[model samples]
Every structure is written in structure tokens, then in C-alpha cells.
Target: MTARAMTQHTEKLADKWGAHFPAAELEVLAAAGYGARMGFGERPALLVVDVTYSFCGTSPMPVLDAVRANRRSCGAWAWEAVGSMRRLIDAARTAQLPVVYSTMLDPGDAAYEPGLWGAKNARGKEDSPAPAAGPRRDNDVVDDIRPAPGDLVVAKGKPSIFHGTNLLDHLIARGVDSLIICGGTSSGCVYASAVDGFSHNLKVTVVRDACFDRVETPHWASLLDIDMKYGDVIGIDEAVAHLGGLTCRVS
Candidate 1:
């Protein structure tokens, strides 16, 4: 789909969540500096969180089947998001910015390996009946925007990529001061990553159209919350334009 179509789709999904906070309230928060924009920095990185087959269902997998069976799948919206995310990824690549992809790894086939999250997703746990010691097939990055030759892929065991991962160190080593983040389950991994990025003193920008969630309400709510405090929530077009501008200035 075209970028315009993707954006319209996102807006329509947000509309399903009913009314948002009043304009007056939003203005008040803005005046109080709650929604300040954390614009891009000289050094930025694209962080794609959990854009895996299990989340977007671009490929058939046992986990995808389970998600559909339980009526908790965001495949419809997530599949739409893939196009926009691809545009952003292409932009980042053209600019030669660091690109990182994160996928959730099942610690083991044991029930408690995923800890609290495993319990929360009891039906959708990553642990397959077969004893596997490594990442599952469904956990691989989606084909449309799979990691390129130099792209860093981090296997995370938690919602936040920073948890038990070298993501922060990697960013620091690359001198990444700003993060352009996108990916699945907007209310979960994306939200957690944005919050952690902010706490770590990095500028965070969330591509609103490039993130998806199983439910609309939490997705919209999380975007609003992140825009208010953690970072800026912008459309994919804006993100691409920003990356293009960065490339121009660098060149």
C-alpha cells in the first residue's frame, strides 16, 4: 500500500478507540511542556522491535496459528505496517544509519523461562513441544524487511530490548544519540523500548504507522502516552523525510 493509505488505515484504527483527550486538555499539557518534541540527532539508529513472523504472520507458523486461534492476532494491521516499515528501513539504509532488529527468543522449553511474560501469554508462549535450544523458526524477522548484511540482530528475552541485551552498549559504541523505533505489539515491546530509550537519555521517535498491536485501544493509548512523555510519535512519511534530510546534511 502507498504511504497515504497506510496512514489513513492507522487513523481509522485509532478512531475505533473512541474519543481521545479533549483538545483543551492536550493544549494544557503542551503548554506545561509535557508533549515537547525530541527531534532527531546527528547520530541516529533504526530500532525494529519484534517484527517477526509470529507477530505479523507474513509466514505460516505454529505460533501464528495459536495467535489466530485465540483471537489475539494483529496480523491484519501488522501486515499493513510492513510496507511503511520497509519504507523507513530503506530510508535508513540510504542514509547509512545503524539498523538493529530485535526478536524475542524463548529462553527454553520450560514454563518459567519467559517468566512473568510467559504466564501472561500462556497460550502463546514461544516454547514449542519439541525441545529446541535455539531461536524458533517463527521468531525470525519477516521477509519483507529482514535484516541486511550489516544490520545487527539482537535476540531479546524480554519486552524491552535493553533488558539482558547489549543493545545499549551497541548504541553507545555506534554513537547513536537518537533512535527511530518501529515494530509490533505497539502496547508491549515497542512501548517498553521507547520508555527505556528515554530513560537512557536517548532521543526516541516512534513511527506511529509502523507499529502495530493486537488491540486498538492499547495501541492508541500507548502512542499518546509515549508522545506525551517518552518521545515523539510521528508518521512514517515524516520519519522518512527526516532521514532523507539527515543524509543530505551529512553528504
Candidate 2:
């Protein structure tokens, strides 16, 4: 699809979430040299950041209800993104491209605790501990798009996977020169990681359809901002299409 077509993603988000991105400002921003398209690189990896049960909740439901179930829940929006994320993941694996997933360190672990997050989000241990009903941890990646045998799973305490983790080194070792980023909280981790990818001079593409946030406005705004400044925020179809043409960086 065209960039214009891709940009209408915000319009779609506005439809679902209820706030229009000012078209006049969009034009002004574009004229001011934002929103230039930097397509994928020859060797790219699919990066799924924090698609955990804590972000997804127990099942599909509205955000308020989802938060009731799990404070970190993005509600039904998380599940919706999971479907698109799964499709893109399957496409990447079928084409033999590297697929990497990131999750938070287990709650209360020395390596997992961070003061800034704790100060802002006081979600106590009772809320995040492993449930008595099942084997899943609060930080576990949702089972819908579970990491397979060869996929790389990185545990991180920070918003960006590149911070305090070997993700950059892993990408460098794999010869990955670009990234297709997906997964939770559009304004948080996904946005952080995509911009970090760009800062490293790697081509970055965030699959809008495969990412979610608790609410819609920030989700819409973050994607538009990323499209304008950091990277190409395109639809899942375009992301999977690019993944289809790539060769594996490793055997």
C-alpha cells in the first residue's frame, strides 16, 4: 500500500478510539520534512516486544474490565493485535528471517526491579504474582504467539529492549540491519524500542496493526508521531510482505 494508504491507519484508529489527528497539522508536519518513508533493509529481524499476559489479561474484553482482571491489561485491544502479530510472525518464520521476542524480567527479581517504574506504577506483588489457577507468570508472553524453538527471547527490565540487554549485540551478530517492531503499549515499550532502532541507524518499521495500548488516542498519536519522526509505521500486510522477500541471516 502507498504511504498515504499507510497513513490512514490513524484515521482507522480514530474510528475505533475516538479522536482525529489534526489533518492540517499533519500537512504542516509533512511540509516541514517529516513522514519520509524509509523502507525495510536487506537483512531485517522481526521484534515482538512485551506481548505478555499482564498486557493482554485473561481474555478479550473492554479495557476497564481487562484492567480489573489484570492491572497491566490492554484489554481486548491486546488480543486483536495478537492475531495480526501472529500472522506477521508466521510470515517471518516461513521466509526464515530472525524472530525475536522480549518480555519483562519476573517481578521482584533483583535484575527486574526498577525505581522509576515502581514509583509511577505501584502495582503491588499481589497483583503480579504467578496465579494459582495456571502456570503462567504475569510477564509471560501470551501463548497465542509463543516463541518457537529457534526464536530468540530476551528478558528486559527497561522499556526499550536495547537497554540493559544484549538485544543490540544479538541483532549485530545476526547481521540484522533493519527491524519490524510489534507488540504492546504503543506509547511505551514499542515506541521506545522502534526509536532506539532508528537511533542505531537501523531501518525501523513498526507494524501498527500488531501493537496496542490501554487507550486509543495515544496509540493513534504514537503511530503518527513515529511515522513522522522515527520510522515507517505501516500496516501488518506491508510488514509481512517485506518479511516474505527476506532470506534468513542464519541457517
Candidate 3:
């Protein structure tokens, strides 16, 4: 495929790396063979990485406003990405593809150690007052795109879904050689998944519109990095088309 053919991020007219990387620097990377497409795989599966209320907050609002509900909240873009994810999920389901979701174990759970997370981040865990938004389901996946019946769910500790989780086993069991990934915190979980998925030799494809982050910078940066070295960061429509092309095969 052409270099620009695989360059369709949700940023519209802007190039994913154009704003951040200087033209001369980007040219150097291109000369060094950095931004070529890794292409898609044969057998594909959808991996929804961390679309929980922690990242999405209680509802659609500004990032700062939603962060009141939960400091991890990424705000409005998270919900928008959720909408895209829902459509992608519907397309995948219609194509009879396996759908897998990854979420964090509950904060109260014995296995849910926040580690440096609780110490560093300002999520009201310290002597700070509780959020004005009241009780929130920090770990549960968002209702806008909850897992359907027969979908696989994995609770993970690390950023990468494949780390210390049975995600690899599930993918191997279903003969999933390609991953169409979506969901929140693109610079965090989604980027980590793309890297690990690539490390596992799986064809990783991250849906640009179907992923979000705390802000635009890291979000686009991670997608650019994933596209450069790890996976194909593509548009939601392309992802839907890819899944739809899988035929009437059973999940």
C-alpha cells in the first residue's frame, strides 16, 4: 500500500506527525524507512482496551468537567470514540468476528494494586476531597458499548492488554492473527497493546476514531508511534471494511 493510503487518522486534514515533527525530521524518518505500513492480517479480532468509566467519566462533557467524576476521565473525546467503537463493534459482530474487551480489576479488589498510580496521580486518593460527581463505576466498561453476549472480557493490571492476562491465549484459541484495537487512553493502554500485539507477531490495527486519550497531543503521538513502528493506525471506516471483508464466517 502507498504511504499516504494508510495515513487516514481522525485528525482530518492534518497529518498525524506533521504538527509535532518538523518536515525535515519527518523526511529523515521516512528516509530511514520509519512510516511504512505493516499491513493487516488474515484472521482478525477486535480488542477493546480499557473503555471503563474511569476514562469515560459519567457522561459526555468537557475533559476537566468529566474529570470531576473521576480524575482518569478523558472527557468528551472518550465518548465520541465510544460511539465509533460501537459502530465498529456492530460491524465486527455482523461479520461474525470475535470481540474481546480488557478492563482493570476493581480498585477494591485484592488484585487491583494501583502501584505508583495511587501515589503519583492526583485522583483524590490522597487527603484530597472526594469528587463532586459522586460514586462512579471506575472499572466497569462504559454502558454505551458494553460487551455483548459471547464476548470475551479480560481484567488486566498493566497498560498492555496482553500483559499478565489471558488475552494471548484467547486470541490463539480463536486463531486470531490480526487485532483491530479500539478504546480509551490511546497513549497508554491502546499504544501498549499495539506494541505487545506487534511483539507477538500479530497484525495490529488501531482504529483512530475508535481510540481517545487525555488530550490530543499524546493521543496523536501514540497513534503516530504505533503507525511508525508497531501497527497500522487507521480510520474507523477502513476498520469496518476490513472486518466486513471477513465474510460470513462464524465467530
Candidate 4:
């Protein structure tokens, strides 16, 4: 098959680091092929996921250099995602759509630490042992985007918002049938949330410009996968426009 005609998963891998993947995901791609054309009804809520320090950049992952490069260097466009997401949040508030913020919560709640990091965690525990002020703080959101009054924040231990969280009930009670998800590490939490949103039958929309990941491969791969299988992947401008129309009707 031609390159564009390549199966979904192959195209996903190829789109990134020229990696190769099986065509098995093509079946899933076919099922979600028309996601862009999917109709989103009234009542949308903004769900921001895992935009925390430990997952974002405070930890030393292989992608940290890429994040730093995107942050303090020439390719800073990636870092602009934070500001873009902020604008989206503002638009959500203006539209009167329910806004939900999701972040990691581990105030002495580190239930899972990799064996490789055991010594580091132990040393840190021995020294101060307490959760640091910024990320571990009970009230802190990310430095980039802060939730204002009336905004709902959901503390989560796992990647999926539905896992060990009251997000589904909150959305259901608020009459929110659609979700606009934005945040860091697009491949992990963002992807997981979108998948769960799909499973729960919510109209899911992911903002391409407003979501960031430390690495490029997984970010792009996850975005394409989500777009092809789970939700509509659009720019923040489109997302805001969609929310704007809804807001005008309700307001």
C-alpha cells in the first residue's frame, strides 16, 4: 500500500521516529475512522489532566532534555501549550461549561515507586521525607494553568480519570455529555482519559495545541491514535469556537 494508505498503527509509528508497527491497529482505526465527523451534542465540560510537576518535567526522564529544549531554547513552541491550554480554560469558563482539573495526588501517597528509584526515594525520605511544597501542595495547580473559583479539581492516583475518581459522577450530574481534555504527557494520562471517555460514551475532544508531552514520538503517536480511535483531535481555536457556540446558547 502507498504510504498514506498504510494502516493506522503503521502510520502512527512512521509519523514519529520512522518506527515500524503492526497493521493490527487498522481494525480499530476503521472503527473510529469517522471520529472527526462525530456529532457532539449540547453540554460540554473541560477536563484537564495530569499537568503536574512529577509527571511533567520535575522528574528526570529521557524526555526531560526535550522538554527543557522546548522550554528554554529555540524549539519553545511546545512549551506554549501551557498558555494555549490556559486560554482554552478561560474560554470554557466564559462559555459557562463545567471545568474539571485533574492532577496527581501523593501527599505521602506514593504507593508505587520504581525499583530503580528506590534509593533516590529512600534518600529523599531520609532527608526531608515530606512532600515538597509546589507539586505536593494540597492547593497547587500547575504553574501554567490555575483553576479559579467554581472550577472543580479532581485528585487522581491513576492515569484514567475514571479510575479511583468521581469524575464520571460529576460529569453525569452536571449534564455534561462532551469533554474537552487538555494537559501534559499526552500519551499517558491524556490518552487514558480519552479512552475512558470513549468507553463511557462521552463526546471527547482533545486540544492538539493545548496538550504537551516530554517526548515527541509518544506525543504524536498518542495524538494520532486518539484522533483515529477515540476522539476528535483539533486545535485550541477550533475547541474554543465549539465551546463558544455552546456558551452563547446557554448564556
Please provide TM-scores, in order, for all candidate models, with all chains considered together: 0.81, 0.88, 0.87, 0.72
lDDT of the candidates, in the order given: 0.79, 0.83, 0.81, 0.68
lDDT of 3 by residue, 20-66 (tens): 66666666556556766778888889999999888887778999788
On a 0 to 100 scale, what is the lDDT of residue 6 in model 1? Answer: 48
The whole-model C-alpha lDDT of candidate 4 against the native structure comes to 0.68
Off by over 4 Å in 4: 1-36, 57-78, 110-129, 133-139
Tens-digit per-residue lDDT, 1-251, candidate 2: 45776556444434433445666666556446667677778888899999998889879999999987777899999999999999999999888888999998876566756647766765654444345367877787888999999899999988998998988999999888999999988999999998899999999999999999999888888888888788888888888877766644435
How much is 81 displaced in model 3, in angstroms?
Answer: 0.8
Residue pairs that clash (backbone atoms under 3 angstroms), model 3: none
Off by over 4 Å in 3: 1-20, 124-136, 248-251
Better of 1 and 2 by lDDT: 2
lDDT of 1 by residue, 1-251 (tens): 56675455444434432276555555445445565556877899999999886677643334446376433346667878889999999999999999999987743424225557656665655446453335535677888898999999988878898988899999999889989999978999999999999999999999999999876789888988898789988898889998998777565
Q: lDDT (0-100) at residue 25 of candidate 3?
A: 60
Over 4 Å off in model 1, which ranges?
Answer: 1-19, 24-28, 59-66, 70-72, 107-112, 122-126, 129-136, 249-251
lDDT of 1: 0.79
lDDT order of candidates, top first: 2, 3, 1, 4
In model 2, the Cα lDDT at residue 214 comes to 97
The alpha-carbon RMSD values of the candidates against the true structure, listed in the order shown, are: 7.3, 4.5, 4.4, 6.4
What ranges in model 2 sit over 4 Å off? 1-19, 122-132, 247-251
